[model samples]
Target chain A: MFVQATESSTGVSHDVARLGRLVRGLPETALVVDAITGLGTTDLQPDEWGLDIVIGGSQKALMVPPGLAFLGVSEKAWKLIERSKLPRFYFNLARERKAQSKSEVSFTPATTLVVALHTALEYIRSMGREKLIANAAMLAEATRAAASALGLGLFAESSPANALTAVSAPAGMDSGAIIKELRARFGAIVANGQGSMKGKIFRIAHLGYYDAPDMFALIASLEIVLTKLGHTCELGAGVARAQEVYLGFVEQEAQAAQAGRP
Target chain B: MFVQATESSTGVSHDVARLGRLVRGLPETALVVDAITGLGTTDLQPDEWGLDIVIGGSQKALMVPPGLAFLGVSEKAWKLIERSKLPRFYFNLARERKAQSKSEVSFTPATTLVVALHTALEYIRSMGREKLIANAAMLAEATRAAASALGLGLFAESSPANALTAVSAPAGMDSGAIIKELRARFGAIVANGQGSMKGKIFRIAHLGYYDAPDMFALIASLEIVLTKLGHTCELGAGVARAQEVYLGFVEQEAQAAQAGRP
Candidate 1:
């Protein structure tokens, strides 16, 4: 099995299309993709990418409580599962697939969470999936722009994630201090780096249920937090950059509408 | 140096009092306890037990979302943290302690979750901590009794947890089937076993935001699911046993009140 856990620790998504080409060489290999944080952040084509098994969680892009998980299985994966020797029960994909085929679940489904996920899915559908993906990408672009405006460095040197922006902390200043000030002073909660990267970087997420106004508020708060932490920068520089990103999108939409007018 | 992660995967709580005795021999060692699921499930005496570091999450007994985590530090633990060489940043307990000393958090705190936790804490206080622990214990006892009445076996043989009851599936029957039927037929969501124990057992949680009526309803549903799954049992057997447990508690409380009358 070729297991590819997409979406990095810093929120960067892997190039699955490139990975798919490699998988084509190993025709018999089962490709398992962990799309936990990738689903709403970017456009994913499992079939096109030859992704055999794609896993997702409800908490991230689905905007629900943590309990339910989703899986996308291909025909090749189903055949592989049939011949697999792994002793499985609760997480048995074949069992779930059989039940799903009958419009049911193999185990006790998280009913409340399923309802919440359904509602979130409906909202995403209404907004259009392509538009939702674009919204995340645009917000991520805005965040990167804002961070640059604040004279901060990007943590992900290559293939930065659309779900969140990881920014390097200023020299000799702990990112934890910035995170602390944001919450204490303005009640804004941002994530600091995980594991070994802690204190070196901070992350701001713009994926799923986030919009331009939320980005504006976050950037504004960030600017205040950075200043409070003794980082010398002009007030509203980050917010202004983010605002420009939003305005650019609005302008594009307006021009598109005008071009299509009867 | 010496860390102890308390709380079991099966929801059982360890005997901290006994563990504390062992820790006393190693004076310089830090006693780190994962009290995430143990806090509301059982009586935890951190200070008295000389527990150096006690960790907790907002979910489980706290009845909040799964973003916020809390830590209780001791003076002895602080000394260890000061000299610790382990590369630390986001989970730096020292930084959190320092920030908390000033009524702040070291990272972007989950603001909404913190607020919800605060409300939950207030409710816990109103109900009284001892009473809360007793409630979980009572509910767990009732569940065990009900399961026994239904001819089901307990998974935890020696140290059963007050948070949840793990029950073994009947011979030749998959617990997953029971879990599925419960959800599909009655909208009740119970958890099946994890890993190796899957298909053999199921778990029913009695911790956090649960009452006697909830237990009654759960048992009633379990009876229906078991019957539908070809398990031979008298209808309402489990529920009747649960009701008896509740009635016993009421009788005891009435007797206590009568004895207290001057």
Candidate 2:
């Protein structure tokens, strides 16, 4: 069964653990997860949660350039691969695995990209995976808080994604205008809604390769853009709110570390 | 209307100036130059040569990761774009130029890659463009000399590119085996020939972000891999030849500078 663990367009993450529980009832079914934008942002335990396959992209939380996609295929998925009759060529996972066994690629891989990914992975390891996750989550929370403080409504109500925050444009205002103003006036470019949601919502990304200062600068630029577009909002309102949220996160982490002290 | 100026597959570069002269003969024609692997490794005067369009890739001479491609479109090409009725959206050079004029992108740009490219560009500027090209040319000469010293033949008969050296593998020896041995024994990865040339030739790259020590190390590894693969070549034979070529280049440059003295 194919499932989108994280919907990139809407920035909504599905509960993989709960999905795993449901998939367990169907013994013949193999769960495939689209974790392209979810890998580094959320806590996804493919092994523990019994996920058959998890797909990832390099440009997301990996902090590397695009052109590389990663697949985590469990032993269960290997059995399916052995029996599956799908037409396969360049994306043949089995062939890739055979080459990987020899610490090589089946074809001419993107050499410089692989080198960049290696550096990015090393950086993630040095930062501690849990802390990196926490950092992303905190940044996402700050973005939400900042948007709320600016009197903007979030597009994702039920389950927001840590990778990005999708906020609705003010009533009757085109999100494209705000996006344009942000780039033209402030030299900041945020994503406008895709497809049907275009001109209705704007997104602020807080995924890998982003930090507190980036979020702060984004929020500040957003405030300036919004105000210039005739939206009545106090100056520095979003930035101040984001700063408060970030400081609160740091304080909570510090307190938790202090409590865990032996 | 479309022409490949630099053929990276065979490490051959066509004379763009000569091609431009022919292209100018046809009023409606526009010359497009593929400078992907050629940029930063050679002196390419697009403006002076009247090239209409030039395409470059970030992963090559820019020393950045992939996912970003650069296009240098002349005013002539812009006129062609206005008249040419091709259904264009993502790869639309007109839209890209508009965005670039404002120092922005039409879509979500590769943020980390752009930042890295900025640093790499700054480094290149500090090194001076002409000197960088000279360095690559010298390195290419050394690689060719080293390959020749090992009794390997050059693949490109005319206009060899400074970016990489394509040399034929020894008689009855597979280039793939040499590439494999290099990676397996010394953790050094080199490129084997592509397509019909597979198992026949090997490539040594001397593009951007590489220097003397890098070439020296690569030559040493090649010697080791060749010896291990039963090639009856003396150890350090290739390295000594490469060192001699490099020193000769330095001496020529020094003598040229002295001759130019006022």
Candidate 3:
């Protein structure tokens, strides 16, 4: 079974843990998760969930430029791949494993990008991966609060990803208008909905390389854009709510640390 | 048929042009040239030589860091590839072409390295690719002249590449000693013979990002290392010869430019 941990295009976060449980006890079955945008920002444990394969991309929560993909394949999947006689060339794991064993890459790699990723990964390690995930979660919580205060509906309200929040545009107003206004006024480039949701929703991304100040600016801009687009919006309403959420998170973190330290 | 325009591993250059002519009448045959290190440093015209495919690397004549491999596939080669039943995932040309037509990469790309390559290519284009190749040829000629003056025999005397010159070690002496001494004394990182010829020869690279001054320094350092290692070499003999070559090249370039002005 192949499933995306979160669908970025549709702003849908799938119940991956539930899916993992459903596929258990099927010895021949392998659960493959596309956690390209979910890893480092969400709760995903391939080992704990018995996932056979997990695919990741560098450009998302890794805070690196795109161009690299990472794969986690379980021992059982390796056995299955070996037995299957599908003619594989470039992505052949066995060939890559053989080269890696000798301390070499199977192909010419983007050397500078790898160096940059190494540096980014070192910083991530210094902060601890869990801490980074917790940061994303905090930011996501703040953004959700801000969106609700602004009277905007969540696109993925049932299951929102910590990496980003997708909010529907005000009734009768295209999201592209707000997206353009944010870019022009505040130099904030938000993503308009893709596919069928195009122009209907705008995404506020707070994944890697984002902080509380950025979220405040985004929410403040969103309020201004909504009012400018003729929607009845109270300026600072969203920003104040977002600030409250941020304040609450900081206090909670401090209390948790205080309790744990004692 | 597959052949290297210049074999960097063995310091040998093949007669690629002649081979291209040999396969002309055979419609089913496609000549593929591995010009990884040879492309910018050597004189090669794939189209003129009826080559169906040419492979290049970023770290070679482009002066960019390694991790990128480029391919020039002719329409004829594409037809053959389409007809062949090969299971290629990552290097799938058709898939890449489709994505590229929509102005996107087929996979997450090392964004920074591509940007670096773009800058290097812009510089290459501004100077003219032919000029860059000529510069490499001049440097290679000077290195060859310097090696001859130093009483060193050429490893690929019959077909030496313009990218680098490989010199045979003195009789009964390992090339590793000369290589180590060069690095230790002058900070020159010359390459030792690879594969079966290891320790038999030392190579002086004059490919991309190299100039006449670098050549002079390398030859002077070689003279010092050879003398220190008990070889009876005149200290300034190679340097003087290289200076003459550099002077000759400058005079020829000035004369040609002067003639073209009229």
Candidate 4:
């Protein structure tokens, strides 16, 4: 069974832990999670949660240009894959796994991107993967606080994704106008809602290569653009809220360290 | 049905045209061709010969780093693919084809290598693909002539591949010795025989990025290495024969051009 750890299109996070529990007793079932948007930003434990497979992409929170996908497979998945009649064609997982064991690939690989990914992964490792995920969560919290302060209704208010924050346009306003204004005025391009959600909500990413400063700048820009597009808001409310979130987060970290929490 | 346009293993060229003819009577069968080493170095016509699919790689003859694979799928192949029960996994040709029709990819592609491949393909197109193939053939011809002059037995004498030429070890001499000696003496590394053919024959590639000067240098190095390894041959004889082949090919090309052949 395939599950999405985070639904990027809707800016909602999936209850992946519940999914593992739902299929724990089924020996034949394999839970494959699409964690492309979740891997770096969300705290995911595929193995501990008994997920059979988790898929990720390079361009998401990994902060690289698009072109590679990563897969984390459980032993159960491998066993099932061995018996699978599916003609693997080019994406032969078994072949890839065997080759990867030897630090080789079954087929040609993107050398340059792999090198870039190596550097990024090394950096992530140095900083700790958990830290990266925490960074995303902090950014998301800040963005959410700013959105609330600016009187913007968030699209996924109940369970907003850490990868990005989606803010819904106010009454009678198209999100496209805000999106265009942000790009035109500040040269900062944000994502619009995909498919049917288009023109209803604009998304602000807080994933890879983003920090507290970037969030501050983005939130500030959003405020100006929203007002210019006729959706008036408090001039400095968004940035101010984000700054408060940052300061609060730093204090929490310090308190946790002082408390000797590993 | 599947066939190879050229077998890089033993440096033998397959009669792909004959294979196409042999399978012409089988309407339900789709002939697939592996043209990885053959693509830019050999003349192949997948459309005309009713080949259902032709596979190629970026590093072979295309003058690009290894990262991408190319496939030419005919209408028959698509029809066959539609009926195929094999789970395509990541190598879903149908999904890829649909996306590619609009110049989009279904999966994350290696962005940097794709860019590199695009640049290499553009260069190949500007130079004309036929010229590249002819150049390979000319280099192979020169290498073959040189090998013969040096008293080295051609492994694929009857059907030598245009991609590369394989030369057998001379009388009780292991091909590995000559390969090592050449590398040690001149820093020129040639491929040793694979699998069962190892220690018996060594391969000299005449494919991508190779020209007359390269061939001359390679052959001269081989002559010295062979002598050092207890095999003796006239030093300038191999180079002279290669020069003759180079001149002959140029004259033939000029004559063909003058005769209004495209």
Interface RMSD of each: 7.9, 4.1, 2.2, 2.2
Output the lDDT of residue B24, model 3.
65
Better of 2 and 4 by lDDT: 4
- Candidate rank order under DockQ: 3, 4, 2, 1
Q: lDDT-based ranking, best first?
A: 4, 3, 2, 1
Query: Scored by Cα lDDT, where does model 3 land?
Result: 0.86
Q: Predicted candidate 1: what Cα RMSD to the true structure? A: 8.9
The per-model DockQ list reads 0.06, 0.18, 0.56, 0.54
Question: Among all windows of ten consecutive residues in candidate 3 chain A, which has the lowest summed lDDT?
Answer: A6-15
Model 1 agreement with the true structure over B169-200: per-residue lDDT tens digits: 99999999999998898888888887798898
lDDT of 4 at A76: 88
Please estimate how well model 4 matches the true structure, expressed as its whole-model Cα lDDT.
0.87
- For candidate 2 chain B, the 10 contiguous residues with the lowest summed lDDT are B1-10
lDDT (tens digit, per residue) of candidate 3 on A160-234 = 988888899989999999999999999998899976999999998877788889988889888988999998878
Looking at candidate 4 chain B, the ten consecutive residues that score lowest on lDDT are B83-92
Q: Model 3 segments beyond 4 Å from truth?
A: A1-3, A14-33, A52-55, A71-104, A151-153, A170-174, A194-197, B18-30, B77-85, B151-153, B170-174, B193-197
| Top candidate when judged by DockQ against the true structure | 3
CA error at residue A70 for candidate 1, angstroms? 16
Tens digit of lDDT per residue, candidate 2, span A28-107?
A: 77899988888889999988898889998888888887766779998878887878887667768898999899897775
Relative to the unseen true structure, what is the C-alpha lDDT of residue A235 in candidate 4, on a scale of 0 to 100? 94
